[model samples]
Target: MEEAALLIDPEEIAALYRELCQFPSLSSACIGPEVTTQYGGKYCNIYTEWSQRDLERAENVKFCRQYLIFHDSQSIVFSSPSGNCTEIKGELLSRDSPSGAQKAVLRKITNSKGEEKQFLEVWEKSRKVKSIELTALEKHGQVYEDDQFGCLAWSHSETHLLYVAEKKRPKAESFFKPKAPELSNEEELTKAERRDKAVKGEQFVFYEDWGETLVSKSVPVLCVLDIESNNVSVLEGVPDHISPGQAFWTPGDTGVVFTGWWHEPFRLGLRHCTQRRSALFYVDLTGGRCELLTGDTKAIWSPRLSPDQCRIVYLENQASGPHQQCSRLCMYDWYTKLTSVIVDVVPRQSQGEFTGIYSTTLPERCWAADSQRVVLDTAQRSRQELIVIDTLSGSVCSLTKGCPLGSWAILTVDRDLLVARFSTPNCPPKLMVAFLPPAGKETEINWVCLEEASPIQGITWDVRTFQPPPEQINPQYEGLDFEAILLRPTQIPQTGKIPLVVTPHGGPHSVFTTSWTLYPAVLCRMGFAVLLVNYRGSLGFGQDCVDCLPGNVGSQDVKDVQVCVQNVLEEDPLNPQRVALLGGSHGGFLSCHLIGQYPETYKACVVRNPVVNIASMVGSTDIPDWCLTEAGLEYDQAALPDPAQWTKMLLHSPMQYVDKVQAPVLLMIGEDDRRVPPKQGLEYYHALKARGVPARMLWYPGNNHALSGVEAESDGFMNIALWLIKHLK
Candidate 1:
């Protein structure tokens, strides 16, 4: 079969490229606002739409977006200030904004018997002197004599005002402080001199000029406000020892409540420390007494009572370690007053550390009803698997057949598991939902067709063919097979051929997928073919491939890309006489080495934030200490063979070979980057200048390593397109 020749014009190709660049990359829309998570249902679940500009600044920002709340198939909870307030059974509450300005709205319904219930609008607006008031259905009351206070939760029964009161120490009292004696060697006084005088004072000092207030004592109380008589009584003792954290009553609307708390000194240095401990304490409404059910050692998070109220299930840290363990499902029985671990498994762990070598792989966690069973997703080296655990029986079952390529491939809600399955990098991922039955054959799973999620835009791509002189259509490799996607330019003359752009992805650990891209289309539109290689160590190929990424295996990635480019050039003699290699970050590092190791292979190069010096990169990144620990290497040059091996790094550094780079180069960086700091880019730029090489540096002032901010992201892609046009010209 003869293939049709591509028709392309340089002007038309550039026009389409520009239009595509303006299109948004990817964005997520809710499955109609709120989806079911727990009682009252969880709100945000975004299903991504790909046509949106990923570079848009506001897209990442979370704001006051309206979501629908479903009460039943027939009735729904709509949040609208314009519509009349309706009444229904069960308590309805508005999610509060972080500012704490407007009081969160709540609607309480006793029954579904009638559509009409008494309308009420009770909220507290801030003013100079503060007072709390409640008015509903001709019933009203005022209760407060405090400077300021905030609402936590209004009683569902409308009997109490659960709130927190704050008071600051007087400026005059806090300003008076003891002076410290200066250390003097000439005058040695009493035992205090030999033992070093210890200063005693409050941790913070208040200054009139600074508008700072010292905190001496803070107390929180649950109060009952008499709606009829207009009287207020403090439910907790006046000089309360308890500092409530979260005080939400149980499911049955019982007088007994749960309050989260931690001891003060134990919480010391804790405000700055990432580790936190929160435990639930039982408080009595009728009797002004509170009993601590659990100590501060255990972390009680997201506590919820069962429908029967007999058992409470919560995610918490059950292990005895300085660092909190990945959360596990724990159950506390009301009757037994005993807390037991229902399911123990690692929740997600931080990236960078692939195995338990230095850090454990954080597993994905999901719990079944009564915490009897759990789904665990664990990743190692590079492979990931889904395991079902019968916590009670200590039995485990495998759910998916192949390992997950990346962490985003699996998700769980309640007992239902959603797995993203893809056979290869070129194939799109399919979403599969399944119910893991207890003992018998696992229920058959069905994949949700996501073709609607297509026309997925914002992918940068280049696709060129490799015709290997007609002698070989395919090449064989021992470890992995090669795959390719070729795009014939739309208007190039059939008498001749086109150029090839070889682009490598940034993260040595990341990959180029059929997931869609923005750059290659621009290249193809510009009358050139592109070859996107999902080389070894690229994600979506399972754990084994990922594990092969480290230890300078990037050479394999380079080999794959170079072979594809060479094969393409062999088929078309009218094709480009010169090939250009380009990438950012780790990819930039590879590009730098390519020009040094195989100088003749590429005609020119553009590198952004390249790691010219690996040892230097390790020492300068945000988590230098963590990186050192993970890479198992010292900062000193002796770590590499022949301490002068640092010279290989220097020789291969793009900066060192600026004069040797016969090709034009464009370098870029974000000034605020902590990872592969801007210095790396600047260093190369200066070197190119010294060598009088045809090079230019483009910089964004306050951008991070990824160029994440709105302006930075936009500038990044735009600069790349412009740079390519200059080189192609």
Candidate 2:
């Protein structure tokens, strides 16, 4: 380990980064293995490996990435490789509906492979009809598509529920334009005024009717479909002007649905409400009546039923003060209709401050496996831990005390505590199971290997010399020095100097942790020195650190990257001036800003769906207005800067900076994206071309904000890989 620390080589680091990048197989492995219970047997594991021969077998092996786990029953189950947004559907039913039985379909659409793969497993008594085999069905006038990204949700029960609420839209026009508000005086309104009103008024359209109905239309629906019984009816009609965000089913399998919606401030008129509103409604299945569960709760998430089905478990969110810094978790009783604050997790430092992101303290419904206890993994004031609260006793115990906190997923089993987690600064994640000895015994965690564990220590990494930052760092660091992990190559470099790739992550709210397998290591192996800094505004450090990065603090994150870039160049003068900046989402925004403002520093840039104009992004993107307020962007029209100020924003926009860029650029976008919509990419690409700059843009027609799904289009994969190799080399 000592020799490993001291023997840093620049070329080796670059090589390591390159090698890390070559693992197309690595991306395929991101979707977690299938863990399912076999009949009369324990849970089984299925892993996927990328084979070169398989590449030729599939239409587009690069885009044909899926982890297929065939169960004993011949049921194939696996997640997509991209590990982003995807719809993974499996059929537990027969190919066709039974002669007289309703369909029990198993379908899930999620962001897995950086895009959404829609999985459909229709359950029939004797056999299951899998959608993956539906290519032949597409010819039969049936088009079954799944959207794993943004607002892609399924209503529980036999009811076909559709909750299309009005959220934010990306910069693209994949969907219908927003409708203009209806004028009370129709005659008084001019033709132009009516057209504008139609454009601003949001509407809703079924997926099948995507074109006829405007994309901005938001109509919430809940329907019951029992083909065998010849019963297909819309259970309840959603309120016309308001969007219904989320809905859930009753345990009795009735059409009864619980729904909620969230509203943000507007750019003009009576916009800029101090706090957003979220309301919960219970719709009776038999009767088309919806009664308010509670009058306008601040926020609610993950409504689950108790074993008896008398009560419900939901997360009640409310801000402590105006700036929305404080947060509390409360429970609402369905029978009594009473709500009470159950947990106060927000720190005192954030109590009343008009400065922070304390939106949801816990992940969404921290309900336990058995529902008798609610578990919360919090790192608000200190390191993260698991706090289990017994509903009956109302007592809270720290289940994961002293455990290194990272993102955690709870494993459902009998009386056992199993967590899927990765420690800090690591790239790979691990699954660990702990046994609570009987009722009275002490708690002890035992490591279980769902998959073989391979820490960075077990893998080979390219080492590069790091020029350390100057002494006298922030005192917030306490006594710890900013540590460095160097990778060295096996052979000396003959090339003049190796290139450096600085890949920053998105989520000014999220941090880079040391968990399991990450792509940066591959970049190092590919012969490029990669530096991943957990800069300011990164989470897990503390609330204060995260709060510092919003708004202009984003520049601080960039500043930190600049210092690291200079440090690497200084330590290894052999390093070429061909440094590149790469990032996605927030990181993409940073990359765009960096090259735009400091074009001389970085050679080439690869930005994915970046939020270019902060004000426009706040007004248009899918993030909440409260989040914008916390970031110091004014919500009111009066507070907003004049269009002249927007010129300054345009200056920082990647589109404006293309003229000064010294290197080639690649813009990747998903057409259907709602987050940082595909339009942002399109606009930027057009701007670059207008400047006669060397720029290329690749768009995934049916893709969304995150390219979370895999497309069986080899053309898409090669486009990006070829672009990088051509420009980087």
Candidate 3:
């Protein structure tokens, strides 16, 4: 048995965390870039938001700024375009009119007493046109901001604004509360007064909302704001059970087109789950009628209208099984009301072939100037690549085929030009722009970098493919292969062997691309080799690979991770004895499984909000369907699982082998987590403690499953480093 130190230096952990905080990351970039005249030349202005750790606040502070990339008639200038801007408060969503003459901004203001108010402000040129308070007493409830049910769109005619907000409901009050004063004979009661007088004691009524991170978002309704009269009206004709979102003005401003998700069966966690049952809907305001655009499809998202407004292109997925899968790109003709699949799901792909689209959503504005081409980013193996699809011919072309080893994501498409962000595991993100080449000439794209790559001093990385042994491979997924990104330090240790830290991503359905990640880079800089595994169920390899892990979790995933580590150890200068594990959520489940199944392989393990017991988790997790489906069983929320089903779930859980775990474990739990309840980690901690095993647990209040609150993440990472250092030695 390996001996571990009982104490670790807190100052050492703090210093290392502070050093890691120096790397700034790009949080988000605006979709459209504006061309402006500056210094007697043409320049492209891109607004990007960045985040960096603030030790004083114990959280990340975001900075929204503009990047000015210079361009000329003859050539483009490659230089740093980083600049600064002041922060705005209470801003929820904002959009500019198609004519660029006016802007609409939505803000939610709250007083010190916790009272909230929503305001919609319209600005014309440099002057404020009007500001209207959208009060719940007179209008709807809070405006929807979650991606699944949020939109702020301007009509082409610029006469109205369309947005999604919560449907209004009567206020719940206590029946025994104080009564209202008697009205005098001269007093006149308005409609609002009359409605307020009918109070009901329904404060304890239960209403299920879209789970996890979407609090107070039960029902979303389409709202149209008439700028001329400043009157907001909730659109009718849509089914009462449907929640509308991603709305846009239809051609001729006759009505609006949006995605409607069914809430009848029950609302599951929507943040990363794209398999929700939904369809494209068109609401005809003039006729007061609603029409289903793509009734054949089960799930639909991001309905983007072409620049010519003749067709709508969107992504669709299967409505059942895994939370995510390869999506099919489909287009709808506005005139004929016909829908056709442009790219179907790819079940298998050979090496260097086009894997199916794994991106959850497309960029806001992705249409090319020709209106026949659409550009988007998707996962291809271990990296994200940008591709352009010709809507007319259905021909797919990779815009980043011959580029350097990195990930490319489209920020926005401006007519003939495309702005993208490129980054590698060692290099920070750099903004770049390229002109769309003529048809069949995509390989000749000339990319001009707006920001130079900032590479970390001692960090370097490469993707390594691993194959499971023939006997260990699942026959159904024989065509699938997994990958691990090995990030190493340039300066080798004195012993010529590096300690290894195996990191796996949370989403069993998610993939870890060859993109810059802070924690792995920090570990590499601290003389540790970090291996990020993309196991069989990870997205981007094809649909078959994703389908392989449903019934075989804890076994297939666990073996693939072991194979990856063993392969890396054989090919690289890594110390097999001094290995540690780091993961969160499903990844954390794998870590716990690996430590217990192969107790001698790892010396230390750390998990964040890990799923330890699936049987218990099924009752508390926001996505109960995930629990049943992943266990290779059917999901019927109304029915309770029998004894046989509970046994199967437990047999596939990490807690089944808890007694075999020898590695010291550190658990980081978010007290407010809804996806994977904190009790999951607490139960495991107590079990390990009872066994007299070395274990420690950290509890974070006001944090969710991601433990992503700035303070929580920072403090968690520091403790993780300390734990690994103390035990790995």
Reference-based TM-score of each model: 0.50, 0.61, 0.94
Tens-place lDDT per residue, model 1, 363-420, is 1225554455555554332334455555456454555543333222344333243323
Please give the RMSD of candidate 3 to the true structure: 2.9
Q: What are the per-residue Cα lDDT tens digits for candidate 2 across 1-729?
A: 011121134445434433332323222222222345545322332222222212334321332233232233222223122332232223221111212222334343446555433333444446753333222212111112212001222333333422222232212332455554665675546654433223222344332111111233333344333433423344454554333433555556454545445323221110112124555677766666767676674645445555445566555544211222233455667667786655554322333122222333333234544556665554332223455556655555555554654334333222233333433323344444443322222234333433333444433332222222544233443322121233323333454465566766676555443333334444443445555554555444434554454454345566666666676677753254557776777788778767876778777777777766554554455443433543444445335555754544444444554567566678878676556656677777777777777888777776565564444233343443345556664
Whole-structure CA lDDT of model 1: 0.46
For model 3, residues 1-729, the per-residue Cα lDDT tens digits are 322222246676567668767566665565334456656676655666667777787766666777666666334564355665556567778776776678798988996989988888899868989899987436788888666778889999998999998887767779888876776654635544645544577888777888888868888889999999999999988898888899999999999999998888787878788988899999998987998999734889999999899989999998888998999999999998889998889999877889989988888888887888999999998999999998888888999989999898987776666778899998878877787887788888889876676788887789998888888788877867889899988877455778899988777999999988878877887778999999999999999989999999999999999999998899888888889999999999999999999999999999999999999999888898999899999988689999999999999999999999999999999998889999999999999999888999999999988888888988888889889988987
Best by TM-score: 3
lDDT of 2 at 673: 58
Task: Pick out the ten consecutive residues of candidate 2 with the lowest summed lDDT.
Answer: 140-149
Model 2 has a clash total of 104
lDDT assessment of candidate 2: 0.45
Collision count for each candidate, in order: 30, 104, 0
Q: How close is candidate 1 to the true structure, as a TM-score?
A: 0.50
Pairs with steric clashes in candidate 3: none
Using lDDT as the measure, what is the rank order of every candidate, best first? 3, 1, 2
Candidate number that wins on TM-score, 1 or 2: 2
